[model samples]
Target: MSYETYAELKQLVLPHLQPIGTNYREAISGEQKLVLTLRCLATGSSFASMTVPFHMSNTSIARHVLATCEVLWKVLQPTEMPIPNEDKWKSLAKRFGDLWDYPFAIGSLDGKHVALVNPMNSESLFYNYKGYPSIVLLALSDADSCFTLVDCGQYGRVSDAGVFQASRISQLLDQERLIIPDESFMVSTTEKRIPFQVVGDEAFPLKKNLMKPYAARTLDTIKRIYNYRHCRARRPVECTFGILAKKFEIFQRPMRLQPDRAITVTNACTILHNFIRRRDGHMIDRTSEINYEIRPNNEQGLMNLRPQQGGRNSDEATEIRDLIAAFFNDPRGSVMWQDQNVFRNVLLLED
Candidate 1:
C-alpha cells in the first residue's frame, strides 16, 4: 500500500482505535496500533515475532492486533463492501458483458480455504479434503476484480456448494429478497430472456440464478465453447483471490488464532483489499500469476471431472444452460476467435 493510502485508512479508523492515557503511563497511539496490525497482516508474523521490534510483550501485540482488525472491518466494510442494490447489480452485469463478453453475469463466485490451527476439542470438523484444517472464505467478485460480497469462517470440511447453501446470500436468493434484476434478453438475441446469474465451478449447483459448466464428458463443440466463455467470465474471482493472497501474506500459512479471531483477520484483509484497489487502481498485471490456458485435453477430460456434489438441477436450470450453449454457437453471440481456440489441436488428433 502507498503512504497516501495508508494515511487515508488510518484516518478513517483512528477514532475507533484511539486509546485513553492514564496517570501511570501514556497509552499507545492509534497510529502505532494501526501500524502493528498492518505489519502482522502483511508479513503473517506471530505476535511473539512482533514483540521485540515493537518493544511490547507478545500479549499486548496480540490484543492490539485483534482490536485494530475489528475496527478496520467495522469502519471499512460499510463503504468498501456495501450491499448491492438492484441498480448496482445491473451495473455489474453491464461491466461483465463489456469486459468478458458474458451477458447478464452479475458476479463470479468461488471459495478459498484459509489454513488454520485446529481449535481445541473440535475433532476433525475443520479438516478438509486437502488434508488440512481450514476455514472457507467464499467470495463473490465483480468484473473489476474487486470483492462484492464475502462469507468467512465456514468449516473447511464442507464443500463449496455446502458452504454456499449455508450462506446468508443463499437464503436471500431463496426468499427472493436480494435485489437482483429481473430476467432480460441476452445481447444480440431476442429468443428468450434469462435471469441474471453468478458463475461458479462444478461444486455449485445449477440454479435459476447460478451457472456451472456442463459435465466435461458430455460436452460437444458448442458446450465446450460455452464452458470456455464461462471460464473466461469467471476468471476475475480467481484473479481477486491471487491478488488477496499476494498482498496479505497472512493467507500464505495457517493462522494461529482461534476460529472467530481468524474470521476477523480474514474479513479485515478483504476489506483492505478493496480499499487498496480503489486507491491504487486494478492490478491488471497480476492476472498472469494464474494460468489462463484452456488446453483441449484438460478441458475435455479433467475439468469438471469431479461429480457435482449438489443435488439435481431443476428443469428451468437445464433449459437455461442449453439456451446459453446455443447462444455461444450462434453467429449473433459467437466470438471471432472462439472456433480457432477450441479446435486448434484438431490436426494433431487427426494425425
Candidate 2:
C-alpha cells in the first residue's frame, strides 16, 4: 500500500484502535499498532519474530495484531464493502454485460480454503478432504475484481455448494429478500427475459439465478461456447482471489492463530484489498501476468465434491441455461473469435 493509502486507513481506524494510557506507562499509539498489524499480515511472520523489530513481547504483538484486525474489519467493511441492493445489483449486471459480454450477471462466486492450525479438541470438524485443517473463505466478486460480499470462517469440511447454501446471501435469495432487479430480455430481439444471475463453477447447483457450466463430457459447439463465455465472465472472482493472496502473504501459509482470530484476520485482509483497490484504481496491468488458477497446496481439494445427487434442477433453470446458450450461439450475441477459440480446443481434446 502507498503511504497516502496507509495514512487514510490509519485515520479511519484510529478511533477504534486508540489505547488509553495509564499512570504507570504510555500506551502504544494507534499508528504503531496499525503498522505492527500490517507487517504481520504482509509477511505472515510469527508473533515471536515480530518482537525483535517492534520491541514488544510476543504476547503483546499477538494481542495488538488481533485487536487491530478486529478494528480494521469493523471500520472498513461498511465503507469499503457495503452490501449491494437492487440498484447496485443492476449496476453490476450492466458492467458484466458491457465488459464480459455476459448479460445479466451480477457477480462471480467461488470458495477458497485458508489453511489453519488444528484447533484443540475439534477433531474432524475443521479437517477437510485435503487432509488438513482449514476455514473456508467464500466470496462473491464484481466485474472489476472487487469483492461484493464475503462469508468467512466456514468449516473447511463443507463443499463450495454447501458453504454457499449456508451463506446469508443464500438465505436472502431463498426468502426473496435479496432485491435483485426484475427479469429483462438479454437483447432487444429476444422474446424470453431472464433473471439476473451469479456464475460459478461446476460445484455449484444450477438455479434460476445461479449458473454453472454444462457437464464437460457432454459439450457440443454451443455448450462449449457458453462455457467459454461463462468462464470469461467468471474470471473476475478468481483474479480477485489471486490478488488477495499476492497482497497479503498471510494467506500463503497456514495461519498459526485459532479459527476465530484467523477469520478476523481474513476479514481484515479482504476489506483492505478493496480499500487499496479503490484508492489505487484497477490493477489489471500488475495482475495480468498472475496465474489466477493456481491454488495453494491446502486448497487443491476445495471443490472436489461430486455433483449433488437426487436433486434435479428446476425446469425453469434449465430453460434459462438453454436460452443463454442459444443467445451466445446467435449472431446477435456471438463474438467473432469465440468459434475459432473454442473449436481449436475441441480439436486438441479429440486428438
Q: How well is each residue in 68-162 modelled by candidate 2, as lDDT tens digits?
A: 99999898888889988878987787677767778668999999999998787778988888999999999999988999999998898999889
Candidate 1 lDDT over 1-351, as tens digits, reads 999998899889999987999999999999999999999999988998888989999999999999999999999999999989988888787778777878658999999999998777779999999988999999999998999999998898999999999997777777668777653544343344566789999999888788999998897888989999899999999999999999999998899988999999999999999999989975442111111111122222211223333578877777777887887787877888888887787553543
lDDT of each: 0.83, 0.83
After aligning candidate 1 to the native by TM-score, how far in Å is the CA of 203 from where it should be? 0.4
Off by over 4 Å in 1: 186-190, 283-310, 345-351
Each prediction's TM-score versus the true structure: 0.90, 0.90
Q: After superposition, how far is residue 332 of candidate 1 from its true place, in Å?
A: 1.8
Q: How many Å off is the CA of 67 in candidate 2?
A: 1.0
Number of the predicted model whose lDDT against the real structure is largest? 1
Worst 10 residues of 2 by lDDT: 286-295
Worst 10-residue stretch by lDDT in candidate 1?
Answer: 286-295
How many clashing residue pairs are found in candidate 2?
0
